[model samples]
Target: MKTETIGTATFETWTVAETADAFARDEIVLIDVRTPQEYMFEHIEGALLMPLSFFKAGKLPGQSDKRIVFHCGSGVRSERVCRAAIEAGITQIAHMEGGFAAWKAAQQPYIGTNMATGAPQRAPA
Candidate 1:
């Protein structure tokens, strides 16, 4: 992964394949920064919900392991949260490129919603 560095933050844009592989290996903490409603509809399996609305660097989970990755419906909010973490002194972080849309597009399996019953469903079939 090519690391993107700015004044203070050092983050990387990870592809869906890379993200999934890392998650499968337990190499990072995958976080979903989308709204609760959005998450309820669909989300990455095993990803922790930490909506951008109230996201705080100190509140982030799996910081001890040193790999916390954020994602949203698209890349926008996740990147915003990444910058916020940088501003809050967490310089090293990452966000999934293209976010969940890209994940689905790449055919990476994830937990999705069954609109008819509003039940969670595993997808990519």
Candidate 2:
């Protein structure tokens, strides 16, 4: 985890491994801030979809009770989401460092498209 502060807000960047472990232990609220189409194609299991196109910082779930960790396709949009949260008074924010790409590169299990049937399948492969 790496922490960065800007203005009066501070945010943390978590590696894919760290995010996965915390998510498995139910220690964080993992949010997928990518497009709905992207999420439908493949995403981490149990990740909440709050597409950046329609993200409302004020609507963050468990903002005060749980650690909200945001992730996007490649970390760009998620970082933007983090800024939005800070602007909305959400101080304790975190985002996956390399996003979904890194997660897959790390070979973490996720809901992936089964090309054979074009259906979502658990991909530990």
Best by TM-score: 2
- Cα lDDT tens digits, model 1, 2-102, are 59887876888888888999999999989999999999888888999999998988876546774988999889999999988888888789999999999
Candidate 2 Cα RMSD after full superposition onto the native fold (Å): 1.1
Q: Residue 103 of model 1: what lDDT?
A: 94
Evaluate model 2: give its TM-score. 0.95
Q: Could you estimate the TM-score for every candidate?
A: 0.92, 0.95
Q: TM-score of the candidate numbered 1?
A: 0.92
Off by over 4 Å in 2: none
How much does each candidate deviate from the true structure in C-alpha RMSD? 1.5, 1.1
